[model samples]
Target chain A: MTNRHDHRLIDGRAVQARILTELRAELERERAIRPVGRLLSVSIGPSPEIEVYVRNQARGAERVGLPFERQLWPADITQEECKRRIAALNDDAEVLGIILQRPVPAHIHVRSLQSAIHPLKDVEGMNPASIGNIVYNDVALAPCTAAAAVELVRETGLNLRGLEVVMIGHSEIVGKPAAFLLMAEGATFTVCHHMTRSVAMHSRRADVVVVAVGKPHLIGPDMIKPGAAVIDIGINQVSAPDGTLRILGDVDTDRVREVAGWITPVPGGVGPVTVAMLMRNALTAHKRQVASGWLPPATLRGP
Target chain B: MTNRHDHRLIDGRAVQARILTELRAELERERAIRPVGRLLSVSIGPSPEIEVYVRNQARGAERVGLPFERQLWPADITQEECKRRIAALNDDAEVLGIILQRPVPAHIHVRSLQSAIHPLKDVEGMNPASIGNIVYNDVALAPCTAAAAVELVRETGLNLRGLEVVMIGHSEIVGKPAAFLLMAEGATFTVCHHMTRSVAMHSRRADVVVVAVGKPHLIGPDMIKPGAAVIDIGINQVSAPDGTLRILGDVDTDRVREVAGWITPVPGGVGPVTVAMLMRNALTAHKRQVASGWLPPATLRGP
Candidate 1:
């Protein structure tokens, strides 16, 4: 039904499904040996948008046969109280992973809460230690969205070694972590941020361009090299000319797709893969916990 | 006596002297209120080369009025024993900072030992948490060599914001951390490594180029843009044409300097500044320890 030579719209849903399928089998096999623990989602304050994320994560856990829980704390909780509760969660054997929902109360320091979560149980990969591990090339656990972007790039079947990648954002979570992940894969990348004089000048010369700057349609066809891969990680809400609200990515997907050899359509691209990555990280946390003796290891095989 | 327009050889000794002077004054003021602690250098084995480093660090500490001690463990010391000793040192009130010398024994897991050192006492900034802190723009404590490269660039009085820079090599301690440090200063940088297709192509377009790969004379005049600043962090020992051994930097300094507006000579460049950074980190560690209540706070002066 589609031209084979035409730009391949990288189906993120397909990639997510594939990864979830593999994880489901692995989780099923591991469940027989040990009792897996539940993931606790800690929401400091009320934010309607975060609920969407929590629901998606809950669904991903369900699909993968992992237990998940939602804990909503009062909006006015003090930073000390938040950290105290997280410390309790860290010591709980049944709590294999802790997810701290973002946009906490004005007074609470988010980084402090993240630091409180034990590194082994940092399923979201937000802890400073988790991020620092990427520098040493220990990236088995990394931020979900950043890991997802790399996963999608891998799905394109492009060799990462020596790949010239232009990462157009420098955010701590996504852009920066993604750059380190690419570096681990031996890709040479240039990180461009707001201060970058000409973002297009760098992007046009890359074999791959990853944009996470949160600007709708910031990248267009003219900025991409023909046959290059484009991974759009930005999710911005914009209003249509006819007064309708819609979600858009940093790239002008429609036009850029014509030039890109492979392109990720944002809503269906990085988002689904991100949720999948969270589920994967949760499993990794379980394995690490068992290995660390915090949780019981698998029983010896039958003689 | 010298041409005003000629390439200025950035003096690392001058920078080191300036930093040490400022630190001496600050240390004198702090010492009047509270007693300072000593730095402990942990050498895993008997490396003749490591003694040189230890001696330099001790001299730097003496100049700044901080106590310094060297603790060399047996070459065959178990990894567990090494960590146990480090843990003990971490708890010692008199021990302000810990430095883990490199080229550790083949049997010892160096990173595990480094991890054993408490973050506050990690004056060398080799801890994962310290390195990770750079991503969040908290760079007060970072790897000494990486920080020195940045300090040298600052010495040139160049505006870091939007500065086009190229970093050659991607070592964990030097090039990688330096890139993050540059990112914190709002510079857009490209990291080139062994896999880079054309290192010169990236270097020739930058306002600044920092090279840390240990291959002597790896960078030459053709790789640099005129009037650019070059910070060479490599320290390599090579046999000269006369069969004499000498230390050389990654850049062909003599030829490259003609094109570079500013350059750091091999032995007098990153090495001196690196030792100064260690002393500075020791001071930072002492302050942090005081703030955390691990040590007594400074007494208030008369109103």
Candidate 2:
């Protein structure tokens, strides 16, 4: 493939690969001593929307040499039953972490199920406890997509301490968590949402701008500073003029890259790194479990 | 006492009084049907600093007709024992909520004890679960001081929707939680901590500025925009020229008040409202418990 994009384009796949390589080596050292656990993906119904995520996560896990399993419950499963199954996974010694697929049955209370996953094994970081820990600057285990956004921002080599960051969303999953993560990095951040009167005003003054508002091309070149880094976490699909489907990010990447010091492109930006973050979180969960004595110490096997 | 301050001074006592009065009436109605539970304050060691807080909380509980209990555990109590006692309180029907006092013994893990308190009985909202819930826009149960700061901002009659809010400080207890509360109220907030390069730059542009950093007189008149609302959550004790003790807030209130449309005074500002917020949270906890079937419905009593 011919390389046409400029150097300002943040290659998320390259970042994701670097993380997986490090994680793979770490897991190899861990596996030499004891057995590693599998990452269990629980889908409490038919969730076609999350199938892509499942495949990406499985691929990432495989690259890190971690076992991956997928479970599909009946679409009509009761919320109580769903929680009961999650509790079982939480207690399972063979399970390293749990990933609860979204778009669960309408009857199932997703938050309740998320809460059921033990924090030590909450690789997806969807649990309220995991989210809450971020407030205390405990960002080791955080939501994957949010962590991924922060990771990409770090990749830009911007000095996080005292950096001006503007997060263009306040969602529970991405924007809010990302704000706390930035805070943990000692960056001063402003959160803007639909309620914000002027997003550009904040973005233009920021050293870095992260958008997760699920709006395509919402940020233009004029909205960014000349040397500011822009992280686009939005994944929106729209039909092009040729009657073909296309994925677009919140930032107008074509024009933004011309002005932005660095920018993350759609499809190849936050998405791949998000899967990589899941892998990193799984390793962190495993290491924490061992440190906390929640899991048995590794028994030396045959050399 | 003669009132010397101008109308710009926000009387937290007044706001607190109004809240307590309404709670008193509501508790009276509940009392006619059934008994309200007591708020148990657990102190691990002898720390005289929180004594005033204990008294204020007791008084607030009394005003609302809720029973209050102050339990002083041994200074050498183990962390496990503290959690055990908290678990018992969580199970007790008479205990409407638990308040784990701060400055716990060095041997004790305070965060662990806070987590031990059941969410339904965490009237102080110090539990991770309660704090995490605020991220999801669930603000009914939040940290008292943070909620008090937000409450006073609301008292200013500023439209929170699209309000330009700048929160100085990022402590987990106050600044961080206050940021989440402001978000829940539809306000655009920026959080500045010790790492922020220019606190005045953000504050000068804010419609409302809330300061929780402990430094006395950290915010000056020049940092604030004219006619803006300033909420001072800092409580610092400093010596006056005569060597007498005087309480000071983060903002230089004397001069800031001239520019600030509304400003809260230290010693009488967030302090009283925090106690009032605790009482309100107690009632909220009780109602949620009842709705969750954790407590029995009140039976009507004969006149």
Candidate 3:
């Protein structure tokens, strides 16, 4: 019998490291000329989960020599106020990118606020316009999680063109955008979601399978095609027997790795890469702003 | 052998008539109070094909009691001139909706001109912003062809939620938007395009299949599941043995109808419904503009 651990485990940390290294060098080059812009993160109220993620992002930005700022608004802030604040940020020249943290106040219309972010500074790529542009194959700025999944597949040295990818999840932020990005790359793909009758039927036939349904271990070994690359985008919290919370992904990593030629692990897989992609997007947003004459090109002049 | 002609063919003309009847009644009600708005269509240069379609649209508009106007532009017009004209239409209070005919002069960036049309007046729903709004399930003014396909599926009276649907082709105007609309309806769907390997594999498993690849007879009887609902969105021109031209759809309708319980015919299937959908969208666009306070509420007053 073959051991599941013997299969290749996609190294998300390595990919993240490579991205940060490149970003660090780029930051150094830009800093030598003019002041680099800061990433603005807006959070309504506080949640321990969001704090941990925000801290991780701050660390990642620091390592890459990128400036980061966190803005905490009162929990009672009205939706209008949020949109107004986001619009102000859109106009701020110093704010290169804006990220409205998830799990915002229940009263907040998250999609409305997301749309208020200027597409140029929408570093998180949560804006509908950015996702829509994917239809036209204009992917300068795409959703981070979706882009990360595509990157992991590309890391396997696979040619995206004509590749068969089955994506299980159709959320606007993840599944749909990822499918669109893959389509743009010339890969024929399928999108499945909660309404899907048989997820395995599609997964078993794909060269690449991306599961982002937020259901722990929803995809098993039987669902994966042998030699296929599996990207697990789900990050679910499960209570262990010891009453400790554990992070889990959509795929049964251990069992799937036995069948899949390559697979991404739960904690170390798409999560780290998503953060790295966020930083990359910020840099991209800045460059685009410069190219579009939104910012002064002279700002890059060396002292 | 079972007769394929026995299966219930989704009648596009019937559905179109149903929609027009409803629109006519509503238009009469609105007209009793104030002058309703007109749908403006801008066509660059002359094409007999486009004229035929535009004439069909005029008839549909007349049937619905809505005002219609067509603006013809010189073929040698610059892109700037095109955008300038579209912007003027955007500012026109009397124009409820705008349609930019296809096959514009070769030099014009068609997409650029589409983007200039105000989203409210974008009756065709070809603008990126309108397409992007589908991400949030805002179908107020979705693309007519895509929406028409969805309407055909709804006409089958099959609950879309949890239905297995296979969509062939991924063109921005048809496949992608249709997929998005189905996703919004809670349907499990797969999108297959030219890069897809073995399109039959996905088609055979679908409870509902929609083909919009513009290839005649791309899907045959062998590809369909028994008792499934088939919606054909393709409009292809083929040459007959006698060198006569004929219209065709993506599916081999006759053979597939033997296996499929519900199917739409080629010329009479999605085509007429699409024209009706255009008129429906025009009315929807007008309503949305009024609701958003962009237009006078008095226009919707009753007798």
Return the candidate ranking by DockQ, descending: 2, 1, 3
Give the Cα error of residue A264 in candidate 3, in Å.
Answer: 0.9
For every candidate, what share of the true interface contacts is present?
Answer: 0.63, 0.65, 0.65
Q: Estimate, for each residue in B1-303, the C-alpha lDDT of model 2 and write its tens digit.
A: 214467888888888899999999998987776677898988888999989889999999988888899999999888877878887888898999999888987888888888889989989888888888888878878999999999999998989999999999999999999999998889999999899999989999999999998999899999999999999999999998899998889989888887889999887889999999999999999899889987768775676
lDDT of 3 by residue, A85-107 (tens): 88889888899999899998789
Docking class of 2: high
| Clash number by candidate, in order | 0, 0, 0
Any residue pairs clashing in model 2, and if so which?
none
Per-candidate Cα lDDT values, in order, are 0.91, 0.90, 0.87
- Give me the runs in candidate 3 sitting further than 4 Å from their true place: A1-7, A30-35, A299-303, B1-7, B241-243, B299-303
TM-score rank, highest first? 2, 1, 3
Candidates 2 and 3, the one with greater lDDT: 2
| DockQ of the candidate models in sequence | 0.81, 0.81, 0.63
Model 3, residue B247: C-alpha shift (Å): 1.9
Candidate 3: residue B135 Cα off by (Å): 2.3
What DockQ would candidate 1 receive versus the native complex? 0.81
